[model samples]
Target: MLIPYDQLEPDTLTSLIEDFVSRDGTDNGDDTPQETRVLRVRHALSKGQAVIFFDLESQQCQLMPKHAVPKEFFD
Candidate 1:
């Protein structure tokens, strides 16, 4: 399921983005600051370049590129 980023509370969204960007291997050795990375992700979400996905079985939320998501999810 797709969870609209706008529906999330500001703090919750920030924490989610922070957690996503902070995960090991996410930065790929880049030296970008956490805040910058968070903002970039936020921008991607707003621009429809990325989306928030909620997995039913795992009961976990993930940030993924829009193109990477399965078309069935959009339906």
Candidate 2:
């Protein structure tokens, strides 16, 4: 399911974005600060270039590029 970023609390959204940015192989030693990365993710969300996905089976959530999410998910 798609979770609108605006619907989440600011602190909860920040934590979720931080975790998404810090995931394995996400940085590749680029040395960017965590807050900076979080901002980037938020920007993507605002631009509709990225989405938050919640998996029903796993009850887990993560950020994904808009195109990376199947079209069926949106329907």
Candidate 3:
């Protein structure tokens, strides 16, 4: 269940945007694309777990139990 960031639901996009911004430690209250990393699925884990690598730095974004990614994409 992988999806392009742009294809995410409005609310889902909001959540990810908030998370990304918060994690980056910026609260300027502006949504701007600053050469962000986009994860690509490498492997699928059991029970919805997955191993994704994004960016040249190899950043990982995992969707846990409580937080589930929708199933309809390959990005």
| TM-score for each candidate, following the candidate numbering | 0.97, 0.93, 0.30
lDDT by residue (1-75, candidate 1, tens digit) is 999999999999999999999999999999999999999999999999999999999999999999999999889
Off by over 4 Å in 1: none
lDDT of 2 by residue, 1-75 (tens): 999999999999999998888889999988999889988999999999999999999999999999999999888
lDDT (C-alpha, whole model) for all candidates: 0.97, 0.93, 0.39
Ranking by lDDT: 1, 2, 3
- Ordering by TM-score: 1, 2, 3
Give the best candidate by TM-score. Answer: 1
TM-score of 3: 0.30
Residue 63's C-alpha lDDT in candidate 2?
Answer: 95
Tens digits of per-residue lDDT for model 3 on 1-75?
343444557676555544554564453664655334212111222223442223335555533322343343343
Question: Which pairs of residues collide in candidate 2?
Answer: none
**True-structure lDDT of candidate 3:** 0.39
